[model samples]
Target: MSDLEATKTRYEVLGPLLDERLLRLWAAREARAIGSGGAYQVAAATGMSLKAIQTGLGELDLLEALPDGLPLTPVPGRRSNGQRSQPRVRLPGGGRKWTEDKDPTILPALELLLADEVAGDPMGRQRWVRSSLRHLSERLAAQGHSASPTTVSRLLKGLGFSQKSNKRKLGAVGRCPERDAQFLYIAAQRQTFTAAGLPIVSVDTKKKELIGNFRNGGRSWCRSAPEVDEHDFPSKAVCQAVPFGVYDVTKNAGFVVVGTSYNTPQFAVSAIARWWQAEGRDAYPGADRLLILADGGGGNGSRAGAWKVNLQERLCNRHRLTVTVCHYPPGCSKWNPVEHRLFSQISKNWEGQPLRSLDLMLGYIRGTTTRTGLRVSAELDDATYPKGQKVTRDDLGKVSFKPHADCPIRNYTISPQIADQQA
Candidate 1:
């Protein structure tokens, strides 16, 4: 048979079994045996480019010239004997060049694109690119850097970047200058109150949940996922649920009052009062002083006059306890113990489960437990709390209120009117 026909027959017999390196080397050996115009003939027969055959022939020459006593290193593929092959597939720096190496300008250009779009903690090692991979690739191409989305992604990973969604890290606009100071003050107060055996409770109104078969956020291990309403329209709900939580810092217990009414100052204070009556008072018996850690912008807000008024009348006067309320700085509510410690657990427990009714939600809250021995109690507060109930200056004056020397607007104490008068 002719050389081309013979080469084709040999390849057809062993082509399926041979890998890239072995195929190239076998073709080179056949070409060398065929003499002049052999490489071109082999390329045409095997459909391998002439460059690959030349590379294989060069490798064969290097193998022959190897100094004696140098151990033959095993490569990745197997030989005809079913043993590891003893030849390097490619020489050093023989494969395709890295995108970064080939186009040095690519990395710098990518960094430039990310400089404006990157969002993460400046001190943190992990950073995320805001632009999509395709968009970034297009931008890179526009800058004369030819790169695919996959290449851009790899480059980003190499540059300590990753895909990340928007995080709620940015604080609210017009952040309080005394934000850090207020946090420190709260910590100090907690220490003091904890030492003195006073009842320290973190209070906050949780996000209002629509009461119905509404879709929840997370997954649950169940036989099947419980179906919920497609759209979360407020009007479709039976009523909104306002869960005002009171988390005991010392006891590691949570008390949540699910209010059907408006989340007014009265509702918030009443929830606190309910918790104290049910759990707090018994947990810290003989504790006359109550330290309340609250956020600065809700029902029990630092600027809410009615919150102070309700705290004085409902909590202090009714229970004959001195209430010290420390408000976390604006936009820093997540730091409140009630948020991360209590509310987060409840949300996790009820995750992906439709809150078909108020009872189901309360059950979920009550069932939530943590590895650190967290216990929770929940109850429905069917009382009507009318919103827009203004607390006039006279009403505020009646409460025995004393602001702290440091961050007075964010920290204050309300004593029982009778106790203040008697003193």
Candidate 2:
């Protein structure tokens, strides 16, 4: 057979069950299969991890060829079975013909960047990363490879090798008692048949505001002339709208409090009270308890001083209902509904519009709309938001909590609609 025919024969052996991901991997180091060793070596040579290599091997539909059990070849020269042992398939690194050519410029520049020595100074490091593409381009040309630096930056980015560290962290592995308990609680709730019974509410405070007239995001008409700033004038810190936003899973509707100070127990309880009175009470009529999914940070945080006990007291005092709050792990705040459902739309609606005045800001917020048929209409309550509102020991001690304390935190219900599953 000709060289081209031999190459075709090699790929034909790769099973049909092999998906695109595995096919691409095998195609990378494909060669004549007659004496080719399988995917493990190919993966190593190509710099893929062992797990990836194993997945590629798993796609092979070699059922017709592979025996049910392997026969031991007792001696070096011979097989115990009547049929001869399968030939040791020696694979070559040069696989299929070029389906697509990689951007020649980017690869070489990336190589140069990875191989280069870092300067000790921070400024020098930043400058080098920005300018490396230009230098690498020249090197590539000298080495008979054509590429631009922009192409290199794009390639590195695709590889997830950022100039700065990606701050996201993975959840803990193995025995994490607290996390395991949270998972069990959520699982138990899901087993409930009633929609209102298993309430899952996502709660969070929106991004903090810079208490002054600052450049807001979204597009606006570009300034005809640049306005001069007076450095001599005292800069004012803008008071933040510490909005406590919540989303009910069953209703698919959200409620929020545009408070200036929400770090205290009173303010936090007030937001929940507003929510229970306005949203949860009418919708889930029989529900007596509320389940809140809040972020680990901000005023609604689980770590915040006396937050849970204080909230429980408040719930008992006002609504005669029990309240339980769940916190999403750190850096997982993006999963909160308020960020996507409420704040994202608000940002989009007010894009490029300067939050020049409180009325304008309030108008922008109240006017936010979504194609999903949800419109966020907000109110600007111009009331004094006192800071450092206390939730003292005496305050909590004065109120009574339900069930006298022997309940499993997970098995406990916040809403009144919680019915026995067997019922």
Candidate 3:
């Protein structure tokens, strides 16, 4: 066939089978088959550049004349034929190397730049910095490295850096020296209560929800996303739902009392009392004591005198059971089992679903359950609870309780004040 006809034949036969690399090799093979000046004809037929055809021809020549008849060892991933089996989109170890790799001092310079923003003890293992990637990139550039914010981000990830939100896990600004000791003590107390077949519950107020068509913070599958009011103004709300949860630690059951009123000590105690009447009494029959694990702050806070007084008057007096209260160290409410085990599930259940009415909020809470056999029951406490109700010195004196030897402020027991028995 003529050189033009040979090139046309090669294109028709190999066009579908060959990629860029193979096509170049095939064109070189066709050029040789058609004899002299055939490279020009193949290039015209295949639309391959003349330089590519010449390079392929050179590779074929080199392969044909191997040194001392050494066995042809083709590239590991390439086909058996001398032709390269893959396109050269990228060469080996090609493209731009990471800026940190190119400049060894970039990461070290970044650390030095973030030294002032590092939180916690400098010598401590856990260190955190609060700086934006753009700021970091600028700082890197100032230190004589060419890095954009994107490059800085990639380098930071390689150096085990990540964007982290502020965790409330940091101990109080003025942290107690006995913080860890208190945690250990609380754990031991819980173990003791569990062993004795006594009832133990973690108590905490889930973030209050505004009852109205407001934007909740998650997604639900529907035909279309629900439209909510643009503004989340409290004035536009019908009422706020204050959920005080009592999570029975052993039973994996939850009792959430949705109060339309303030989250006072009275309301906190009321929720526990309601749990006892509804579920706790049956769950722990003949139990002499009740253990409450709570945060160090809030309505039932360790420092709240009214919290103690109300516990004395409401829970202890009503049930006639010795109530042992253990408050987690300041800024450690996240560790409370109620927060993860119960409240989280409830929040997830109602997420993205607007609470247009108090009843809807209560219904959502009650319907919350988990595959791990978590059963939650919710009640609406419409009774108004007065806030800032102070407990008098006389009332405080009437309360009977003993502080634990370890961490007195965090661990305490409030007993039913039996006037006749005490007398």
lDDT of 3 by residue, 308-332 (tens): 9889888898788899999987756
Per-residue alpha-carbon lDDT of model 1 for 170-247, expressed as tens digits? 544676789768877987898899789888888888889999989988788999889888999999998999999988
lDDT (C-alpha, whole model) for all candidates: 0.84, 0.52, 0.81
lDDT string for model 2 (213-254, tens) is: 566554656656223233312245456666666666555566
Give the true-structure RMSD of model 3: 14.8
Comparing 1 and 3 on lDDT, the stronger one: 1
**Model 3 segments more than 4 A misplaced:** 1-172, 419-423
- Estimate the overall C-alpha local distance difference test score of candidate 1: 0.84
Maximum-lDDT candidate: 1
Which residue runs does candidate 1 get wrong by more than 4 Å? 1-171, 419-423
Ranking by TM-score: 3, 1, 2
